[model samples]
Target: MASNNRQNSKMTDDGANVTSTPSHDTRQASSSIHVNNLSYDATEEQLYSSFCVCGDIKSVRIITDRLTGNSRGFAFVEFKNTTAVSDAIKLDGMRINGRPVKITVAQPRNSINDNRVVQNREEYQRNTPSRTRVVHCKKSQYDVYIGRPEYWGNPFVIGKDGDRSDVIRKYRAWIMKKPEMLERAKTELRGKVLACWCKPEACHGDVLAEIADND
Candidate 1:
């Protein structure tokens, strides 16, 4: 057996710290119990049959390995009433197949990433500015400023007379420029438009007029 770590603690067969009941406000009307310390040889049907003594059973599942299809040594048994779940926990550590069992209320499965992945993703998004854009420079220049052509003078107009090396350097800086306006423009365009085109009219006059009117 592999030694257990915090990340894989819930995978254990000992239900001691493996399972917990839902909060008073969230407890379901149905009674769902987690059974641990199950015999690797025990089948799902056997587990359902064993727990049926407490009350009517709704479902049973013996969790198994995905790759090998072998039992993970734990199972979930659901009863028709919440009272059954309470009663089952009292029978915790009861013997089954010559081995003691651990029983408790079953909890919902945490997603694969859970809190750790969420925190990391949030931190990354926070540290990095969302509006930054990367553009390649056509010319070489160390210093460059990025602004809209309508608002800021055309960069190409100034670089046109410079030496080839200087022009290349300036274009490179333009490519690397990160501007707030560019970020805003990207945000405005994102997901707003779909890849689509209007059907063309066989003739130019009325069809063009109709298209313009529709716009």
Candidate 2:
């Protein structure tokens, strides 16, 4: 009878232990989250400090532009406790550094196929004709056409009656070879006809012609 009672007690302890494991798993899963819509000037320390109000922060990462090393305006913060994640989201759009910040749980990174689809969609939007304008090349002697964004559309024909197609092809090649030039042109022509142009669409041909003639 003594041996039987000991065996029954051991079985009861095993059942209790089994029931507690899932609760521990739930606690582990709730801790981390993703944050977004960060200010361009935000630093990791600032982010972590801001989030600490909710709970203990395990880590914080702010994504930045690779070339310029500037903030990409987003970040991810992980909490040591799951309850802190909920509190952090409640603080979403909370002001930090004089700018509103967006915070949310981080989704798992997409697979390669998903990334390819996103890239293709962005490329399609960028290449659409209505969205871009053709500009006559002013930099070269030939009748080269450049494509600019519609907002910055300022197409110009450097020489009289230049072939629009040839200009477009040349501009496309130039953009591929020297992509930085496009950004420079945008900055140079800001708040005016040239800055808003999308290359190769000639959306601002007349305005560009006047500007060139004035020059």
Candidate 3:
């Protein structure tokens, strides 16, 4: 992942230029942090100014609506080291853009922790009624695990500029080819509802729902 594209320096209300620079290497496997409750208008520059104080940031990706390009109120920040992740956790209740952000260490897509999660999901599926529904996401009810598309952005699908079909194909293949990776996703959506912007038109969410709801 590339570092944030915004300029790392910002001017405070007192006309002070505050620059936060990353002093580390490229990235670590588990060095990413998940941030929620972000103000809708917050930008990459704002996030860099807030987090660059800890260490080097590899990237900042705020989830957004593919069609409207509006903030989905959540983002991922990858630091250059584990230490920075720990420091970021302390900022869990710190205000940014007028809202207290919730921060946590993000688990990588493939990890030993994920294996246990898959096992738990298998158990949950066996115990519960199994079905699936698709619905539009209200701001507050977005399921961080299920509602969020695994292939929403980079490191999953390399969707070219304006190539929506390529993105869809990749997301579908991820769900179909690697069923093991989606156990938690399946458990989250099985017999439950999921939120997506498009319906009746095939989408990444439908790919997930199809794989999760069926055998």
Candidate 4:
């Protein structure tokens, strides 16, 4: 119930605690809204064009399927202030890509799969105005980035199948193995920001945050 605890404390409807991230507290969540019933064909540009009339939008996040990389029929839209939230809500029945969408205030994530990175690093997104806003992996176009999926351990098989988490898992499974690599990671991440990447959306950086976050 403490402030940090509440900000950091997220739980599922069943009451299980899971890793939550930057989407809410990381940005002006008060001005953000959740969008549902999206057409898979909807583009960020289309959503922005639709909602821009309400007010200046901070960002628009369209949820996507990680493995297959397709739209998941939902997204988050953030404006410069809460007033736009009200205006945006009025457009709930508006269509994008020919689908009438449903709109509502955004909610905090309380599931493992709904993961993201923490922003403790100083230089990660330092110059960005909305640096607190988390980013999307594919959207950001990064070859290797930190995020929530890394923390949740979603069966990353390697060479045989998976790769990222698979390598991280094997790191622990063997460190029982390390380059000192584990120690180096800890040292490098010290005194930095936490999950500043794609919020509410899971990322591999989540695992990095957890690892360096611990003793």
Query: Best by lDDT, which number?
Result: 3
Q: Relative to the unseen true structure, what is the C-alpha lDDT of residue 61 in candidate 4, on a scale of 0 to 100?
A: 94
Candidates in order have lDDT scores of 0.55, 0.56, 0.71, 0.63
- Number of backbone clashes in candidate 2: 27
Q: For candidate 4, lDDT tens digit of each residue in 71-122?
A: 8799999888888888898998998999999999885454543443334334
Off by over 4 Å in 3: 1-29, 111-215
Error of 2 at 18 (Å): 29
Clashing pairs in 3: 22-56, 131-191
Say which candidate scores most in TM-score.
Answer: 2
Off by over 4 Å in 2: 1-30, 110-215
Q: Score residue 67 of candidate 3 by CA lDDT.
A: 29
Q: In terms of TM-score, how similar is model 1 to the real structure?
A: 0.39
Candidate 4: worst 10 consecutive residues by lDDT? Answer: 128-137
For model 2, the local distance difference test gives 0.56
- What are the clashing pairs of model 1? 135-175, 137-171, 139-168, 139-169, 140-168, 140-169, 140-170, 141-168, 141-169, 141-170
> Using alpha carbons, what is the TM-score of model 3?
0.41
Model 4 stretches with alpha carbons more than 4 Å out = 1-29, 108-215
TM-score of each: 0.39, 0.42, 0.41, 0.39
Model 4 compared with the native: what TM-score? Answer: 0.39
Per-residue lDDT for 1-215 in model 3, tens only? 77674447889999999987756664445788999999989998889989999899999999885423568799999888878988889889998899999998897776667899999999998997647666565533444333344443223433452255676777666555554446555566666666665554455766666656764
Arrange candidates by TM-score, descending: 2, 3, 4, 1
Model 2, span 1-215: residue lDDT tens: 23322222223644652222222222224466666677787788888788899998888888864433557788778787778888888987888787887777775454777899989978975775332223435533323232443433323343553566555445444443443544444344423333323334443443333323221
Model 2 lDDT, residue 91, Cα: 89
User: What CA RMSD would candidate 1 show?
Assistant: 23.7
